[model samples]
Target: MRHLVVPFALNALRRGRSIEQFLGAAGTPEAPGIRWAELRPTAEGFALVVHLAQDIGGEGSYDLVEFPSFEREDGEEDFGCQIAVVDEPLAALTIAEKRLGAGRDRWVNQGMAGDEYRDYVRAGRPPCLSASQSEAECPET
Candidate 1:
């Protein structure tokens, strides 16, 4: 997909979290106005769903993105610049930091964007991507 995603999701997942729970869990460094990022693995790579839980006076919607991972000529992982916005949710989207779980395997979506993040109370959703955080990574996909 081609959606813009905040970097907190990857950072928080590295810390053993699905969606970041505490404000400081993944809000450091840039401190996005909005919070929460969910990552799901795809057969070719992975998918990311970011929720902008808009306030009473704002608009809330789901932005989706995908990254196709591959191996380079040297046998090393080469996630090319092929970030595209996928229509599919990859998995159930969730805003709960704690319930979102961590990334699959050691891969985490690493990218940055915060101008879109807005304020919010909370959102409803699945228990996180803990069921299978196995294989995928997107560099700001």
Candidate 2:
């Protein structure tokens, strides 16, 4: 799985080696998706940027997603901000993962042109809720 390669990529970035990873098939404007993620070492830590699958008339583009601050196992708090340099390679990759995860349900996840999407659309695009119907769902924002 692609997840297994993430740690090695992070290690390479931490060693000052910029890395680019192709995440999924290219997408369209109607449903933008993450094409690749770039990691560049920085003075503060590192910068993570992702190329959007759909470009503007063939021109390349990038987008960043905000990740909520999470408590670290050591009891430290993360900044929980987007487009900010991260202090650790794993942290930067974590942000990139969060960005990639945002589009986890897009058609690209299935394939370049998988028929499963048609069935999903016909099925009313049911969501993968965190809790079952028997359990309380997260309150609406």
Candidate 3:
């Protein structure tokens, strides 16, 4: 089975380190059809975000679709899955892993980005999901 995050990130998170990483489409960098995930402490609690790239069009630009989407209440617009917020890091990590595994094929995680993903986590998980929003705040990156 394809792992959601690398072993290092998973182990680090289990040990209570806040980190983020993405795995998908090797050699494409931030091109369309890439997926990334992050686990960090937030004001509310530990937050886990797994986002998939959706081609929004315009010069290789794209948007993101958070995974593990839940059903909205009646009359609510189905934008995407809500950022999973939990009181514990392990809980968030579990959900993140599950979400990533569920779409393993689409994510195309060929295990080629392992080293780069580790560097990304060490770099404080810089925003690298959407090239179109490089200047904008990555709420979901």
TM-score of each: 0.21, 0.41, 0.39
What tens-digit string does per-residue lDDT give for candidate 1 at 1-141? Answer: 323244444444334443311111211224222233444434533344433222222224323112222333467544222223333332223322223343323223333222122212233222232332222223442
For residues 33-131, what per-residue lDDT tens digits would candidate 3 score against the true structure?
A: 344555666677777654444322222222233222222345543342345788866576566556544222222222333444444445554445332
For lDDT, the strongest prediction is 3
Instruction: Report the error of model 3 at residue 2, Å.
Output: 18
Alpha-carbon runs more than 4 Å astray in model 1: 1-33, 56-141
The TM-score that candidate 1 achieves is 0.21
* Predicted candidate 2 versus true structure: per-residue lDDT over 108-131, tens digit per residue: 211222233233334443443111
Per-residue error (Å), model 3, residue 23? 2.7
Worst 10 residues of 1 by lDDT: 20-29
Worst 10 residues of 3 by lDDT: 102-111
Error of 3 at 137 (Å): 20
CA-lDDT, candidates in order: 0.30, 0.41, 0.44
Task: Report each candidate's C-alpha RMSD, comma-separated, in the order given.
Answer: 14.7, 12.7, 12.3
